[model samples]
Target: MTATLASVPVRSRSFAFILGSPRSGGNTETLARYAAEGLPPDSTSGWLNLCDLPLPAQPAGPVPSGAEKVLLDATLESTDIVVASPLHWYSVSAATKLYLDYWARWIALPDVSFRERMRGKNLWAVTAYARGDDRDTEPLTGMLRRTADYLAMEWRGALLARAHRPGDLEADPAILSRAAGFFDPRD
Candidate 1:
C-alpha cells in the first residue's frame, strides 16, 4: 500500500523510496517499485521524488526548514531507505547526490542526532545502467556502502539491473524475478 512520509506513523517497518531520476516511471524507479512488492503485507512504503523536492545549492550551511527538513524527517522515520537512481557516469544522479549531501549538514546540527539515529537502519539501492560491464556499477555501490558504514547503518545490498530504454525493465522477466526477492530478509 502507498504511504506518505508524514503519514507513516512511528511503526515497526516502514520504508522510504527516494526516487532520484529526473523523469518518472524510468527503469530505476520501476525496479524500486518491484522491489517494494517484496515487502511484507503489513509494511508501509512511501515515495519521495527528488526531482520534485528542490534543494538549494547555496553557501553550504545548515539544513533549511523546507523540503530538506521534510526529507530529513522521512529519512529518520523510515526503517529502510531505498535510494533509486539511474546510473550517471558510474555514480549516483545529481539529485541523489544533493539529497545525500544534506546528511552531512544534518549530522552537524547537534540537536538532530542524525548519525546516531541512522545507526541500525537499513540502506538499499536500486539502480539501472544503459551499458557497461556489471562491475562498472561498483562506484555507485561502493559509495553507498561507505555511506552506510559511516552512519553505522546496515548495508542491505542493491538491486542492480540493466536497462537502456524507458520500459526495458518492464519487459525483462529475469530482472523482474530478481526484484521480487530483492527485499527478502536474509538469515
Candidate 2:
C-alpha cells in the first residue's frame, strides 16, 4: 500500500539536496528542485552534485580539501537533507553512493564522528526508477535508512517516483503531486 504523508511535519527546515545525476538537468535534479521549491524561503538550501565536485577515490586518511569540506559541512549542518538519486540496479546511483561513501572519512576520524555531526538531523530520500514496481525500491530504502541510522539522524520519509525518459516525472501528475506532498513544508 502507498503510504500517506499527512502525518509528516515540517518546521524551520534547512535542506541540502544531494543530487546524484551526472547531468545537471536530469530527472532527479529536476524533481529535487521541484520539492525544494515548496520550502520556506528562510530555510537554507544547498545542492551538492557529485558530478560537479568529484572527490578522489578513497583518499588516504582524509585528504581534506577546503571546497569538499565546506560542502560536506553544509550538508551535515542542515536540519533537513533530501538525498535525490536515480536508481541504478535497484539501488542508489554510483555517483550518489560515492558521495555517501566519503562520509566514512568523517566517521573514521578519531576526533570527528558522524553521530556528532548528524545527530537529530532530518533525512529524506528521493529516488527515481524506471521500473514501476514498489518492490524494486525496498533495497534502496533500506540502504538509506541504514545510513540515517548510522548517522543518528531521523528518517523523515522518502519520495519514490518513476521516470522512464527525460522529463517524464513532470508529465505525470500523480507522481508530481505525491512528491510535492511528501516534501511539502506545510504538510
Question: What Cα-based lDDT does every candidate model obtain?
Answer: 0.89, 0.78
Model 2 CA lDDT for position 157: 76
Clashing pairs in 2: none
Q: Each prediction's TM-score against the native? A: 0.90, 0.85
Off by over 4 Å in 1: 1-11, 59-63, 185-187
Model 2 Cα lDDT, one tens digit per residue, 97-128: 87778777767766656668788888898877
TM-score between candidate 1 and the true structure = 0.90
Q: Which candidate number maximizes TM-score?
A: 1
lDDT score, candidate 2, position 159: 82
Residues forming the 10-long window of minimal summed lDDT in candidate 1: 57-66
lDDT per residue as tens, model 1, 1-187: 7898989785568899999999899899989998888886677889999988878874245545878877999999999999999899999999999899989888888889999999999999999999986798999999999999999999999899999997788889999999999988541
**Candidate 2 segments exceeding 4 Å error:** 1-11, 60-63
* Candidate that scores best on lDDT: 1
Evaluate residue 8 in candidate 1 and report its C-alpha lDDT on the 0 to 100 scale.
Answer: 77
